[model samples]
Target chain A: MEGDIASIGAGLAAIGSGIAAIGVGNVAGNYLAGALRNPSAAASQTATLFIGLAFAEALGIFSFLVALLLKFA
Target chain B: MATDTHETVVSACLDSHGGAIGMPQLCGEWIPHQIFWLLVALAATFFVMSRIALPRIAAVLAERSGTITNDLAAAEELKNKAAEAEAAYDKALVDARAQAQQIVAEAKAEIQAELDVELAKADAQIAEKAAESEKAIAEIRDGAVKSVTDVAKATTKELVAAMGGTADAKTITAAVTARMKG
Candidate 1:
């Protein structure tokens, strides 16, 4: 039963991580398009883009941690 | 005996396993995996942004900057040219003004010189006319004096001839004296 629960938690974690990744992809795609259109603003926008990517990736990281925790603890 | 003990230990371990088991978890800490994936994603994003996006953007920016600088330099050169042209025009204007003044001065001098020459000529003519008038007056006076002397001499001769016939010395003398006195 514990193993089954752990498996289920791991599966949810994967889904959550996948969803976060999708969000990051969207942000990056939009940033790229905008950068292409207005190259002058790229220097100013790079930091913001990285910050957004970091936040989205943080969520995925949290989900992965939950999966590991459920499995181990 | 060792094989029997190994089997017993394995069975014990399997029996202790939970029924809910579907997958095995490798470790208690998921942070490592999370960090690794996050790093991977960030690296990928940065790579695309730097390699693909940033270089093109920089190139575009550089081109625009170059164009702007070239335009500014051209404008500066044009401005300098215009200023030089203006300076040249001003210099020419000054030269023209000076030349005109010189011409005017020269003309005035020439007019003054002509006037002086005319005045001198008129003065000479007046002096010449005055000398001619004086000469004419002197000649007329001399002619009048000569005519008066000639008339006196002729009258004397006529009187002497008329009183000479059949007259004594005293009578002639008395008659001549009377006539002369009268």
Candidate 2:
């Protein structure tokens, strides 16, 4: 109760990081599904899969960064 | 007075305890500093990536694809060569078989001609032997007929003398000849 309202904003921003986790899971899960359906093509698409993971994880990192900024910037 | 004294003693952005008075990230005083460093870092990353990492990756990919294409071409060529070799082998086999058949036919013809010649020689030899045998049989029959005619003439003369009748040799011969002729 004695803390500033920015701490509340920071806590809310962390929720976005958790939401970003859902996006990352969606990307990985879809890739796995496609890979399992066509294993012969999986080897060629590994690079694309890693790129998707990086893009998904970048958003999660951004949300975590915003949370840090809100908390202690 | 307390707030003014606190702001004067400490800096505008820091508390007396050395903590930030507010969000330092949004402070106008440090915006240029952050912007300049951000640009510098981004430029450095772009230069390294564009000049080194990206070109290496592209070259590796190109080389790998080229190698795969070359290998595929080589495999195709080898397959064609194998087919040609097999065709050549089949042709050679056919030629050899034909030559063998021709040799067999030539040998058969030669053997038949030799057999025909041997058969003709044997026939000629058998015909000569048969003719000689027939001539010998005719001479023996002529000798036997002369002997029989002499024996009958002597017996007829003896019989005439026993009967006390004189029979002439010429008459007896004439009668015997007449009877023998029948």
Candidate 3:
């Protein structure tokens, strides 16, 4: 039971990564909906959309890092 | 509350354990390998994205913009054409109106000329009738004067004869004529 705590922590971190994925999906979905509506305006906002995607993906990466930390350090 | 205490205990244990964990990623021998692979993967991704995918995306965007601009230009041309057509239509309407007015004026002038001719003919007929009436009146006056002279002459002869005086026709005519003249 004592040794299993690390694996449980890693599993929770993996769940957090999954939650981050939902956040990333939210950002990407909204961007696509808006982009498809006004393709001309989409070009100007593409950088902003990508920045939002990176921010959400960074959270997932942080979760992955935490999982790695629990497993290895 | 119980979970929070357990999390703190695990955190303290992790702090004490340092790098001594059970995962292969923490092993010293794999560090170089992981770094090398990470670099390779990053380089490949950057090269592909920048050199291939991004350029294709840029081309599609440029084509879309070109299509939009060309369509807008065509719309502008059509709009100008519509305006020109409308102007021509208005000009034609004005010309038609002017032509109609000109035709009406010509008809009026023609009608006026006909009216003037008719009026002149009527005036001529009226003048002829007036002259005929004057001639007729003069004839009637001459006839009435002759009748009156004959009656006066007959009356004078009767009166002279009744008084036992001889009446000469020549003398009576002369006297009556002189009296009338005087």
Which candidate number maximizes TM-score?
3
Comparing 2 with 3 on TM-score, the higher-scoring candidate is 3
Clashing pairs in 2: none
DockQ of each: 0.06, 0.24, 0.32
TM-score of each: 0.34, 0.41, 0.42
Give the per-residue Cα lDDT of candidate 1 at B173. 49
Looking at model 2, residue B160 earns an lDDT score of 90
Fnat of every candidate, listed in order = 0.00, 0.30, 0.60
- Chain B TM-score, structure 2: 0.46
For candidate 2, lDDT tens digit of each residue in A1-73?
A: 4888878998898988888899889989998999999999999998998899899889888878888887877
Which clashing pairs does model 1 show? A1-B19, A1-B20, A4-B20, A4-B21
Q: Give the Å shift of residue B19 in candidate 3.
A: 24
Reference-based lDDT, each prediction: 0.76, 0.87, 0.86
**lDDT per residue, candidate 3, B133-159, as tens digits?**
999999999999999889888888898
Query: DockQ for the candidate 2 complex?
Result: 0.24
The CA-based lDDT of model 1 is what? 0.76
Between 1 and 3, whose TM-score is larger? Answer: 3
* Candidate no. 1 TM-score: 0.34
Between candidates 1 and 3, the lDDT winner? 3
lDDT at B72, model 2: 100
